[model samples]
Target: MSGDRLTAEVVFDTSVVEDPGDAVLAGVARVLAGAAPAWADRMVAWSPEPRERREIDALATLPDVVRGRTRWATQDRHTGNVELRGATAELNVVVSVNSSPLARVGGRLLLSNGITLTGLREQVAGEPRTDWMRAVFGEICAATRPVWGALYSASEYRAKVMADGPVLRALGRDFSRHLPGLFAGNYFGAPYVGLIGERVFERIGAPAARKAADGWFVDVLHDPFAWRDDDSVTRNADLLAELGPECFFRKGAAEGRVTRAPDW
Candidate 1:
């Protein structure tokens, strides 16, 4: 979030889904069905390397051919897959603006991964993220209805991933992950932008919580990196704790944390 590139992610749990196909192609269909039921045909996926650039319209076919874990990346670089563990399967779908041509935006049912939840992140460069982006992300959060999710600066996210202990307890991703279910997944203290699913939203009652299509949205700054030293970070972190301290491991994680301000 140095004002040049901003990457944001949202993660949720898609384990034990509503449907898992019995055959390979059928499973693919099921996967597609949930890829982005809201956006429908707007979502698309492409095959991995060593394989030609094969684009698979996820919404066209998925989750119906095979009732097992799978992994696939889209043409836009978003990654999603149903992971298998012993006899259980979980979905991890990632949506991001970091990839080139950020057009595709759908996979699984939720985003991010820390442990029990899955994840999806977006990255955008050249400008401060717009409220429209945040709203769009909010819409995505509503669709996924994740237990909790966040939009953090890439640098801030990396920082928490490096310094925070229970961040896993807060958030999770599919590829490199742990089983953390704290709140807002990897949000060390409070996210620059945060979202709460229905269940928790009904409980926390944060005054600033805004009602979205399907979830509750919260934010501490206009743009994630807008201010590196604003006291609002601590105030926001305190508010999060005041609202739902048990939702996270370090309720005051964002306190005194200075991020790189955006140039815009």
Candidate 2:
């Protein structure tokens, strides 16, 4: 059987201590280094019954996917695949951060930083379903949410933009500022901006209190209902909107469920 191409990107920016670009890179490294679910917990999740240890093997080799860079550039394809019940999904990730200096605000220097997580995946027929990617992304959320909270010590952060599939493609074309050849397939991202206190400046630190607006997109995707097989932009938007900023858990996809939609 043939395979279907699926790509996604989760892009966002939060207040970072010191350099914005460096901080975002550091944050992602920490997450992939077993910061979110913890290496031990993920090992267990990979082999719940102790015999299914393929993921364990994959986990040992995950470090290759965890990458960072100061400048925005096209990366050599870094691809890997996982079996997802009836399908084999191939995926790769690219992370980039750009920092912008802004005029001082509230008696402190203001900065506008950018972070982009671009990835491509192809789901081919025939395979055992797995949750490794979801698990990894969840860990990413766990790792970044608190940092966003601390960065935005005042007013809080909210997703200003979110896109998927063709809509995302169109948005990318319209903007045309993203790195050339950075996106492989349809993209998915949620961009935001926020403010933070000047006193909290450092390279890396412990997580702080979290807020509803912080990492809302990641929170939504972590839910089982985030993925769909259909190519309808309107439908996906409705699904995401339904999962609003305040909703952190699944509430049943009874209304606009796309049963035939492919899982991401």
Candidate 3:
């Protein structure tokens, strides 16, 4: 279910854009299409003005399009400043984009749901701010209501695991003692979350573990069995150096460095 894409209608407001050409809309559509389910289609505005309403028009004649002004509007306050109002579910998003002489594009995505996501691109500002534009669209795509049920279940699991913290740590130690090969190496490190609270002992004390997991290395580094030797402080320092200073560490934890193993 996590892999399944979301399905929804994507309606773009052409008025805020500098140009409402087909090419511009098509580029936006391309990125939006990637985040949407395979069945979703791009619905673009063919005309600048609203379509004429008919009393007896057939449903078949109507395009599968959202044909109304999103009630929200942006008022210019002063240079580099603007005011947004009427942002709600009934309104469409108000986007204001500015591409600069330095080839950087910065923009704000004001959603109908009263949420705003800002994007700034300095490294690579693609054609007509495409990179920033795609980021804005991705933010819009990700604006979903949280599933409280899932969150509650996850919280309960966390509580259960933490309630037996001591037992878990003992079990981890037993596993490490019986299977040194599974742990006691720089190849595997600890995770920031695992080192929180009393879990510092889980890494710095027994295993001499290094850094925390960051997505790709989550399983490898966070595995309880993947710890360093109790006396392998220098190895842990070397591992931290290899992992770079940017790796996440527990708050208030000493900065890692390449140093000799000191008697504990």
Instruction: Give per-residue CA lDDT, model 2, range 54-147, as digits (tens).
Output: 3323333333222211222354322112221101113333432223333333433222333222112322111111234444444455444422
lDDT by residue for model 3 (43-71), tens: 22222233322221221211112212222
Instruction: State the TM-score for model 1.
Output: 0.46
Prediction 2 TM-score vs. true: 0.34
After superposition of all CA atoms, the RMSD between model 1 and the true structure is 13.2
In Å, residue 187's CA in model 3 sits off its true spot by 21
Query: Could you estimate the TM-score for every candidate?
Result: 0.46, 0.34, 0.19
User: Is candidate 2 or 3 superior in TM-score?
Assistant: 2
C-alpha lDDT of residue 84 in model 2: 14
| Highest TM-score model number | 1
- Model 3 Cα RMSD, 1 decimal: 19.3
In order, candidate lDDTs are 0.36, 0.27, 0.24
Stretches of model 1 off by over 4 angstroms after superposition: 1-4, 16-53, 57-128, 164-207, 251-264
1 or 2, greater by TM-score: 1
